[model samples]
Target chain A: MAERAQRKIPDSSRRSERSRRAIHEAALALIGEVGYAKTTIEGIAARAGVGKQTIYRWWPSKAAVLLEAFLDLTGEAAGAGEVGGEGESESEAYAIPDTGDLEADLKLVLRATVDQMNDPRFDVPSRALAAEGIVNLELGTEFVRKLLEPQLQLYVRRLTAAQATEAGGVRRGVDPRIALELLVGPVTHRWMLRTAPLTHEYTDAVVEYALYGLAPRP
Target chain B: MAERAQRKIPDSSRRSERSRRAIHEAALALIGEVGYAKTTIEGIAARAGVGKQTIYRWWPSKAAVLLEAFLDLTGEAAGAGEVGGEGESESEAYAIPDTGDLEADLKLVLRATVDQMNDPRFDVPSRALAAEGIVNLELGTEFVRKLLEPQLQLYVRRLTAAQATEAGGVRRGVDPRIALELLVGPVTHRWMLRTAPLTHEYTDAVVEYALYGLAPRP
Candidate 1:
């Protein structure tokens, strides 16, 4: 509708899509450069080469714009197969592969996650959002709901499949929701705190430790 | 030296100690209320009813002051035995008790940690520092090194004790540093992200899952 009011382009839909993508990239880049506190919708609009009205028409607030952009960035990484080569669509990008050999499959996905987290593109903007989220309850909840929870659910599905008595990975009574934390939490913590390096070797160890556990296996 | 120059009370040492305590309290309160950016030495001094010079004489920067005050607050909490009844001294406050059963000890301390993290006195200011630390690379590194790593080392010691042939807790060849992450990482993530409620039940579950792991036990 807005495009129709503007000068004619090659294709309205393609033009709209391009503008949408530019906004996402601009929002992420602005936040990463200036930090979340200073990032504004106007700055994003200026960077994206779009009018502020266009952003406002599409998204309600700067946070909405930034968070959606954040998710889209991760989606791009997923499409790049940074997390897994199988991802093609938005929904598909969120899904972890299940090869039935749960350990190998989980390891494969987690290593890819490590690679994604390590990518400066994802890491920079994410740190800005995460830092802001820690202090802002509403934004943090939205972040978890919109961005983090969806990805976690994919782990839930994969783990749930493994819980099948016939397939046999997770124990029957084990809750996938809680189980996913052990797999994901360590990596997230190390990345967030910079307490340790996020290496393939490190992620592989996390997977092994989480699968087998600390207690001596009898 | 400054105390000698000022009006002396019945006991100068007691007066100095009182001023020091007030400064710590003020620093924590100011940061928690106004956030790290707005918080300043003047603000802390004003709230504490001390000379700004006094604060500067003791600490080089507001961050240094705030972090030390944070450690003191936790020390006070440790003295209260919120984590373990055995705590008294500063070092003792950091130590995890060895009741021979590693799981019980870890769970006890973790439950205490959950309690501490939940305490508004600890939680509010911590959220500020944690948020700041996430974006500020130098501050984040100092936070992990000075505050978090010490607590983690206690776990390492406790787990190391368990790894003894006779004690038999954490399996041999399992790195304690990595193992500690599995236990601490989940609780930290949930707390930092505000993704879920921080309850004793949740932490107990974390301790259990971390000990046993995801794969179906043989």
Candidate 2:
């Protein structure tokens, strides 16, 4: 097993990683410039200075390439906050903090989300992909399942942890899944529709409205 | 004033109305097939069997044409439910029925929404426009202002009414605007993402989850 693992890590592995990063950047840039339907595998390969087979060997389709590229982008962004000496883990890259203070924790994460949404680096490509997702169900579901749901589940975990705590943390009967939507949905609506500007203020409002009922608390 | 109003209704005006309806239908059809960016005023006029000047005389842009076309379609749908009784104003056509039962009213409207979301006639064209809106901010804001917000406001009105009532109803402190998002956002999320099959059952669940605090009720 050790020998097989060593063999998998070829001397060319570092070159492969560089090629992969180029391919991902090219995919995102192309999708952002031209819409998704017009973005072809050959186009991405040409932009990346890579042979088409290199991308094909890694991803089956353009959608797969874009999805993985986005995933990689999000992972890198999340990794920036890593407290050194803990060694990076997948959980550190994706996990929502469960600080026992559900409200404060949720507020912190949502504020970060507001900042991300405002950043053109994230927004432009995401909007392009989302535009495609609006019309393409197969692609939409794949992206949602792989990218969106995992992030949403982190909220679920945080909410569930809140539910488990003694004293009135979260209401017991609350389905964490649906409850999380109350937090996420409004922000998404604002972002997708461009009905309003997304800001820390707006996200803070959403967090407040979701946790404490919009109706006057008795 | 009445004589002037009558004189304004020329024979050409009547003919223009017919041409306008035809143009709207053509725009919707063409957009549904080729999508918004590819959909053109000339194409719409050609499909409608009208002169390009006829379309130009009526609307400034293709976006304006599509927006009016959608508004007309919604108006027609709402009209079908009207019994054509005396004093049934235009506002009545757009208003969500307040049957004094907020939950039931919301469910009925949302169930109808589920049907509309599933219907190919509405879904196909809507997806095309929505896809364009995702990337186009000015067009998107126009859509939200003219179309989406009016519909959302109906919920705001209903929630406000519920809050005003003395009986067990929405809490007064609840901002009707934000309160409405709780109900609308999740359904939109499901429909837009195709995360799951949208059904009356799912909408019912959203309403239930929203109204009865997810946390255990005292």
| Candidate maximizing DockQ | 1
Give every collision pair in model 1.
none
Lowest lDDT 10-residue stretch of candidate 1 chain B: B82-91
Model 2, B19-39: lDDT tens per residue?
989999999999999999999
lDDT of each: 0.85, 0.81
Q: Give residue B200's error in model 2 in angstroms.
A: 2.0
**Top lDDT model:** 1
Chain A TM-scores in order: 0.89, 0.88
Per-residue lDDT tens digits for candidate 2, residues A100-128, read 77767778888887778888888888899
Q: Candidate 2, which segments miss by more than 4 Å at Cα? A: A1-11, A80-93, A165-168, A216-218, B1-16, B80-93
User: Taking the candidates in order, what DockQ does each have?
Assistant: 0.74, 0.44
